[model samples]
Target: MKPLLLLDVDGVLNPMGRPTIDYRRYRCTIGTEVYTVHLNPRHGRRLLDLALSTGSELVWATTWEHHANEWIAPRIGLPALPVITMGPGRPRSEHGEMFKTPHVAAYAGRRPFVWFDDQVWAEDEEYLRVSQGLRDFLLVHVDPRHGLTREHLGMAHEWLTLTGFSQGP
Candidate 1:
């Protein structure tokens, strides 16, 4: 079986911290007071497209939640993916905090995998550090200007090869 690859949409795939003329809800807070939120620069859609083409089972681990599929995916010309929605409040690690690594690892049958996200540090990095094979698992950071740059994708391709996810690099 091919190893799993994790992907991040923000700085890795979609560029945030920029400007957005259009407005769309990116998050929701079902707490004492209900609220809908929008990210500063929403570009997750484009990143979604790039990720899907790779033939990996995609998961949305961002704060966007349902909005990623409801709004962002359509706008960016990408299809809906398995979204890993966060709860109202949850304790997170110092790095790779949001990543549900154990779940992901289980989902992938404990096989090798890769992750691409600008926000992941704790779970993702730690998994890479402790996993059986170092080169089999990879984490790619996408550049904003170039949708999914070749460098990052190429790096993933190499890592995938190392893990037997692909026969050739």
Candidate 2:
């Protein structure tokens, strides 16, 4: 099975706090609520390049859920991608992992995956370790202030390359 590249919108793509000049503000209307997001177009290209080189499929694993396709994808130059359905409410596991942890695991289904999120904690890592034994997975913690950086992508690239999941030089 092809490896997966799991993406989160809030911190990973639409970074919170102050943003750099490279990021552009966008107005997204989800129902009656309007949300402003900061996005860097270059991130889209970089993510696509990384995925292509790694032979990985990008899947959204965020609270935005299907809305990511509507608001996040186009501005970032990505096409429609699969999204991991989040369970209702903000449920925490006994391990204290975030609600998205179990859902991401079920969606990944033993496939090697690279997950980008700011909320990932040690607890999440521990949970994944016990749940997905021997599966190659990389959980990249993207800082909400900086969003996704070249350095972050580099880490993923290096990991994928080392794991024999990358098809590029």
Candidate 3:
């Protein structure tokens, strides 16, 4: 089984939930709550295309799952893909399972995995710091930017190759 690509949409794909040049930031209302997020249809398309071409399965770890598929995915030329939904595999946390990484293991069937998110940090840099199982999963953090910038995409592509998620970047 290929390790799953546990992706966060806002900062990783759509850019940080803020305003900036090159992209316009907008608030997205999902369910009863609203969140500020950036959207670049081009970046979304490239990400979707990369994942598809690499044969990497993208499981949503972001709250944007509901609207991501509805509006964003279509703009990127992709149908709604299966989302991991809420927590990947861990019990819900007081943080509403946002820190959930265990689920990546389950979602990936314990295969080598890479998690791309702005939320992961030095604390979670080494999986040993989080969990023994997570030690094998690659966690890549993206800097806050207007949208999914080229730097992050390059890192994602490189990490994917290193983890054997795909052959070429």
What TM-score, computed on C-alpha atoms, does each candidate reach? 0.59, 0.95, 0.71
Model 1: per-residue lDDT, tens digit, 24-118?
A: 44443334544444332334543443345444555665566666676556654556777655556664544443445544454555556666666
Question: Which residue pairs collide in model 2, if any?
Answer: none
Q: Pick the candidate with the highest TM-score.
A: 2
lDDT of 3 by residue, 1-169 (tens): 6546666776676764565554545666667887765566566676666676566666666656566776556654566766655533446543222455444445555566567777776655544334444444667777656445667666766777776667333
Stretches of model 3 off by over 4 angstroms after superposition: 17-21, 24-27, 87-98, 127-130, 145-147, 167-169
lDDT of 1 at 106: 47
Winner on lDDT between 2 and 3 is 2
Number of clashes recorded per candidate: 14, 0, 2
lDDT, residue 128, model 3: 30
lDDT of each: 0.53, 0.88, 0.61
Per-residue lDDT over 110-133 for candidate 2, one digit per residue giving the tens place of the 0 to 100 score: 888899999998888888888655
Of the two candidates 1 and 3, the one with more favorable lDDT, higher being better, is 3
